[model samples]
Target: MFGCIAAGRLVQTNLQQVDVNKYVFELSDPQSINHLVVFLLGTIPFEPGYAATVHLLWPNKDWQLLGGLSNEKPSAIFRIGGGKNNIMMNQPTATLGISIEPIETVQQLLSTLSSGVMKSGGSNLQHAVSMTEVGQMASRVIENLFNYVTSFAVQDLPMNGIALGEVTERGYLPVKAFQTWYNNLSRKLANDPNYLSSEKSA
Candidate 1:
């Protein structure tokens, strides 16, 4: 199953089936999004022998193959925007694509991916699949996990009124198990987006 989270919003359910074996998520607030996390919900796997590929499309920009996820590793995250390294869009919208195809497709895409920045959308998207599992609950959960630190983006912090101890105990940690690791990373970046780079430079 495929799912995505952008700034606390569950977007996988909102994906539009734009073409055969192709699904698109319409991002309403591109700037507010710091990262886009795509994942499989839980136990389901691609019908044996197939995989799902993630791609991004920015108008007037070449289609970029973000990466591909298979049953072996069901989730992958992409820093599409908001990072110092990703595109800073002046426009209000961007599209995220989840492609379904045979296992061989990823190998071919990787060849293009290693060679340079963009791949031909014509050849890459031409392949087709019979189905794709769109992440419903798990997608949102995973997105929220990576996105918790940016919780301050909306308006106010979610656990604002409550005491810190109670908030941490009752509702914070397992947000919204993948939480265990991303929580730490999200907090670190939230405190300093370039913390890792800063460390390496040190």
Candidate 2:
């Protein structure tokens, strides 16, 4: 269940747990979306005694994994795309994939990708680039109204920081994971007032 209070309007989300491991959110039109936030609440299970990892997949095949969701820490709320890596939005197809797995497995999987131990599955990465051939561009003009909210939530300070320490101390940290965290945190800090104020005050 999710609720957002904006401009005196109450928007509520009521989702049924029909599936134990998968959930999908579809946005037909993404032009109006400048920011997105995600929250997970409940007794989230881990992967066979290992720390859990969440994967975020996009229509263009862009994917990111987030770790540290388990029975001990059952609640997670995050501002997506605010960190070093902004959210990927607006393509021909609009679908988001969210799933949970183990942190170690996720690291090894990505490592294999870089070490060339794992080969690309028939150039799937190349196909993602060809998606923009259908002319999907826009130009805009006119007056705009903006209502700014001064207060915002701060968590996961180092952009996937939680998983970084877990993986590094466990053994080797995945380069992709570190980059994801670093960039996402950079982006998030850029957007966050708390970080901005602290910098200015310093």
Candidate 3:
């Protein structure tokens, strides 16, 4: 069924076994979306398209949907907030939470493409073109706002003082020290003849 799913509206129906693994709800009013809450009447995984509608209650009357799990085993409740349409005139900023799969998939796809190119022969013009296409795709995927947040959250935390190990035995340091080391490494990389030549050819 194709129809518009409003940001602040609730939609309920009964289906014996709904497998929403790949199903997605495309919202017509993207900007007006405040929050989406989903309630499942049976045990089910969080489907991609299922969402809940936000209802404004009292005092905190500008009712923002925080996060919650349904009281019943078969039921699931989700709260969505933060979109152009969800903002109130006199409220402090409300954060909209959205969980998106990371761009690791994009990176994995690029890696596969790179492997194919390597197998095909790096000197092949076709392989070069494919590599370029993959790179462009990667850049576009990384630029997506949701992907950016997911990447940041999933990335490994950087170790402290790893850069200053040569100067200090502790192998940990502050931001300024790391910046200096990073700058030096950047300069070296920038001046490397092979790296420059490869970049130019690409």
TM-score of each: 0.55, 0.33, 0.20
Q: Which wins on TM-score, candidate 2 or candidate 3?
A: 2
Backbone clash total, candidate 1: 2
- Write one digit per residue (lDDT tens) for candidate 2, span 57-140: 555566654322333333233223422343444443333334444545444443443332222122121101221111011000
| Clashes per candidate, residues 3 or more apart or on different chains | 2, 10, 18
lDDT of each residue in 113-163, candidate 1, tens digit only = 633332223333221111122222233345445445334323333554432
Better of 2 and 3 by lDDT: 2
For candidate 2, the 10 contiguous residues with the lowest summed lDDT are 138-147
**Cα TM-score of candidate 3:** 0.20
Candidate whose TM-score is highest: 1
Whole-model Cα lDDT of every candidate shown, in order? 0.57, 0.32, 0.31
Best by lDDT: 1
Which residues of candidate 3, in runs, are more than 4 Å off? 1-7, 10-20, 41-73, 84-202
Model 2 TM-score is 0.33
RMSD per model, one decimal = 10.9, 16.6, 19.0
Which segments of candidate 2 are over 4 A away from where they belong? 1-20, 43-52, 60-93, 107-192, 195-202
